[model samples]
Target: MKKIIFSFVTSVLLLLPNMVKADEGMWFLMFIKRLNERNMQKMGLQLTAEEIYSINNNSLKNAIVQFNGGCTASIVSPDGLVFTNHHCGYGAIAGLSTPEHNYLKDGYWAKTRAEELSPKSLYVRFFVRMDNVTDRMLSVVNPQMTEKEREAALNREMEKIQKENSEGGKYVVSVRPFFQGNEYYYFVYQDFKDVRFVGTPPENVGKFGGDTDNWEWPRHTGDFSVFRVYTDPNGNPAEYSPNNIPLKAKKFLNVSLKGVQEKDFAMILGYPGRTNRWVPSYWVDQQVKYAYPAWVEASKTAMDAMKRHMDKDKGVRLKYASRYASTANYWKNRQGMINALTAHKTADQKRDAEKKFAKWASKDANKAEFGNVLSDMENYFAKTNQESANHNYLSIFFRASRITPLVVGFTKQLEQYLSSSSDQEKEQIKNRLEKNLYAYYDESYYPAEVDLFADNLKLYAEKSSSIPSELSQVKQQYNGDFKRYANDVFSRSIFTSKINFDQFMKQPSAEVLHNDPLAKIATALLTKYYQKTPEEEKLADTYAKAFRKYVKGMRDSKISTTLYPDANSTLRLTYGTVKALPADKRNADVKENYYTTFKTMLDKYKPGDPEFDMPARFVDLYNKKEFGRYLDKDGTMHVNFLTNNDITGGNSGSPVMNGNGELIGLAFDGNIEAMAGDVIFDKKLQRTIVVDIRYMLWVIDVYSGAKHIVDELNIIQ
Candidate 1:
């Protein structure tokens, strides 16, 4: 989350301690077995025995779908009816909805296929092929080359690869190194540019319990949205077209009516954003103590401020929902991680891992290199900690308000003075500003951000003693009065000062930007101290070299493992058994299950509490025994499934496939107990929770009467 190299290494290294000698010795064997297991049993996967015969075999086809778009989805119908998580399409869905048609609150449904709303920009990709070109790519660069030289060489190599493989097309192709640097794969994708909205349930249905219910099991959230991918007259990817044809996928998943039963193998395939399973204990401790708590507190402060502001202004609430939700997500996740670490033996396990790494390094033939690497890493961690804190503080401040735009404009003016630019470049700068201007109008754009910044400032002030001396001086200037500082910094008007930022927008941007409090702070920080800080320059160079080295090292040491570093944007595959394990040492006996009944939902409800109250539709469904076609093997209706398949943020829309490779469910969230899976993947604690596809179809058929959509599914039942 912090984007530190130490955290990245720690994520992988931490797992090493728990692994036995047999696990290490049989890594290659187990890797092959696991690959075969995934291909045979996982979602949209296919592999032959010959493909798994050896690691060197290139017969296995690429199993993942690629997309220029950010999220993943599955084609449930031959007509190209795509299903993904609601949050995955929230931006587009929200973009198309307004006060007169609040799709988020009331849901959206097209009477006919033609009535589907075409989004401004939406697309999906399918991976056509992948070639192992690592050796060829790296052959252009010397192994002993400097980081800068390697980078320059890599750029040229990539340019050549892209030109040759692109085939004069707009398709996105990326050459990714695997196994540290021991292998390479060239991924070629076919992009479908035309995608449109079909349907989405209301937030009450899709998001259901909101922040409280997120990442928790017995989840009632439907979490489904429907979209259609359209193609041009030539049946190729294209922009929005009134007469576009439906794009048919070469490998689309068939939605299975036979849902997951107990211990049935389930696998998820998509771009799992990130996991920091290899982080050091020091980093983990820092996160548990400082980073997470700061995030939670800041989010709480901002949410409270937004609620107060929104209570008197509906327009403001609508505008800020996205911003509020973003903060709330981080806050909720941080809290979950805190709870998870407390519940589990994460800290103890991390310590054990450090010891194991040290032992292994002693016996390793590359002991000197490994020892130096570890020491360098530790030294880097210690040097960067304070600077990292400072960076976080500044990032939070900049992101919190419109001061960023003003600063950007100021920087552009400075750049223009410093360098001569062509007419095309000048136009690009103008276009970029205009684009950002539209983004500035969003409700959460100003008020929620300002509040978050103000809150973070308070936290920073409290933690000032721990910060670098230079940054501490800046924090001291703020003292402890966040509200006072916020008023001075962000207030464009009295109403805006109170968090009703929509009211403040009545004043022009110039009026606000000229007198805004943060401008002065920005000016002072940017001009006088921050821009010239030795620590800043040193850290920047360090990170630059580190990144280049990381890329080169990955290219050089090609170690093959099923586990891949999350790119935050790319499709991924995760495979594991469904095991109900304890949350932590404190709850050693409690094993998580796939489903929680209506009985469990009712037990948690308090009649008079607004947060706990079930909506009438949900109550009616429960009371009427109207689960439709969603009964599991035991004849009980299921709401969610808790699996051991490792997943995280970008995995929102991933399909949970059965061993037979049938679509059993859609993965949307994980249990709160497994929130730390991003940093330290505890198979014992982490669980990828999915919305049972059976329940989804049941709701569509019985509840919404959208059986036309259901008719498209290839249901076994």
Candidate 2:
């Protein structure tokens, strides 16, 4: 009977082409020549594969980098001028800004090299090279080995791979699993630590739409920011130094003033963070119904609490600006994902695909390896749905509340002290812990806002089926009102303020830490959240093995021919066209839905509005039509444009280059219509939002009169 079921599914699966669209997939650079170059050229790309990626020669790959390990950025000038999104550099900019300087609010431009500011920590990782390591990696594991044993063996081999490729510790080497661990690849990178800020548009312009228009279409934000990478006198990566100079880049993209047109070829190269395009139906269902909602609600709760205090005090607002924007961005994103996944019926689609896969696996030839894979996954997801939901909420609680870390840190240091060997070692640990405790309090502790954040804990407790016992006990004592409990803790706990912390450090006691109210809450949350249940432990081992076999079967059967591995923060090239969505009357004034212009900015502008307000100079320039060379043939200055190039979170600062490989725009966002692009590409709706490079040049050369900066760029008119 099982064989019959498998035979039927196999027939169905063979008939299907796996539904991978021409424009989908974050392809590896090494495979571009064989897998994508021809298709890309047919779509209008003029550059040869060798011109894009070459291990021994300077190519486009040399100009692109992973910005600070989280975003993409490109080198645009011989002087190492780096271009990326303003939001990508927000943390560094905010750190450099003071109440008096207010760089973020008023905007910043380094008139000369000496004016650029270096934050305490900022780096860019240039991709050196990558190679297939599948055979080497797979040799360490066997089918009969448990998942834990497989993982340990693979990790040991991966460490050896890294060491071999590190070239005496000069390069950072990473071994990443692909196709759910059926294959592996090793990447080599060189990190430059002396990156310095160059320029940015004022907050009003950079974040023009703010939270209200973050993931929405028809965006008018000037979202680009500039930085410069510095190196030692010998042009080697080094720590920050006054003696360091701008790097003479081996390759930098030529800035193209010519704007994009509908159907024009577009390509993006960056480190896309993550994707799960081949997951089973159960995983998608769990994310939509349980995980995403919990995250969305928890994020919103924290955002509202932070905003309330932020609005009341300017200093507080400045301090929490980055956190608020980050929380609110995900708050909208998760909700968008929920709406999109449901609207697109993505789960149903996955289910249909899985049925075909199951049938294929059930065949007599394939039955032994994959027959139980789907059942195991389904059973695991079913039992852990609620637990998964609770886990997300608690995770957000820890991230949202700053106090949790303070308590956790103090407790860990105390534990270390107890385990120490001698009085001298204990004293040294005590001194270091005391210093960190004070610093944490100074930077993050805020009693009023933290107490307000605790309200989220109550929300979690109410929404989750189960919670930490310590949290439950607190709820019982406070009659389920977390606000009172938080207030009591803040008033008495040492982690609440430096005065309290300093006093406690003078006479630190393990009993005090063990009995502290905040410590109890923190310990309960941390212990329960990190400790896996026996069921989860068993499932983890089983799930890993099952998925590995499931993907292997798909490939072995030729069902996923030409399928690229999921994005895992590696250098990849995705190419498509400057595609437009269905014409909306809202954008009737513009030529097409592929891009937006200054007119859209004015239309959405609101006086004194945080998101829409424009700088006086910007408004004056728009009124005078001072677009200069940046003006489009349509006689408008393009702000943000759209393309069908597949991208995700870490692709934020990625360069959106044209056919000739000249930089045209900066890929900063994805349209809300296809927020599910992270998991599944909706070829028709998924579009990468880009800031026109011409607009960035205008902001610096014309609007801000920083032409010296423009003189460094290799501009192609």
For every model shown, what is its TM-score relative to the native structure?
Answer: 0.78, 0.94
For model 2, the run of ten residues with the poorest summed lDDT: 1-10
Please report the TM-score between candidate 1 and the true structure.
Answer: 0.78
lDDT of candidate 2 over 1-717, digit per residue (tens): 334335534553454344335578898898677667767888899999999999999999999999998999999999999999999999888878776887888899998899999987899999999987887888878998988898899999999999999999999999999989987889999999999999998999899999888888888888889999999999999999999999999999998989999889999999999988878788889999999999998998888888888788766677777878888888899999999999999999878777878889989998988999999989888988888889888878877886675577777777788777789988897788767766555445375456555777888889989887777788899898788777888777877777877687678777887777788777778888889877778898898888888788776776654368889999999988888877652366556778888877788888898888888888898888787788988888888888888999999999999999999999989889999987788877888889888888899888988899889999899
| Model 1 bad stretches (over 4 Å) | 1-34, 38-69, 137-152, 177-184, 339-351, 359-368, 402-432, 442-568, 581-592, 602-615
lDDT of 1 by residue, 350-378 (tens): 66755655555555664643444444445
Supply the global lDDT for candidate 2.
Answer: 0.85
The prediction achieving the highest lDDT against the true structure is 2
What is the alpha-carbon lDDT of model 1 when measured against the actual structure? Answer: 0.61
Number of the top-ranking candidate, with TM-score as the measure: 2
Off by over 4 Å in 2: 1-22, 417-439, 584-586
* Residue 91 error, candidate 1, Å: 2.1
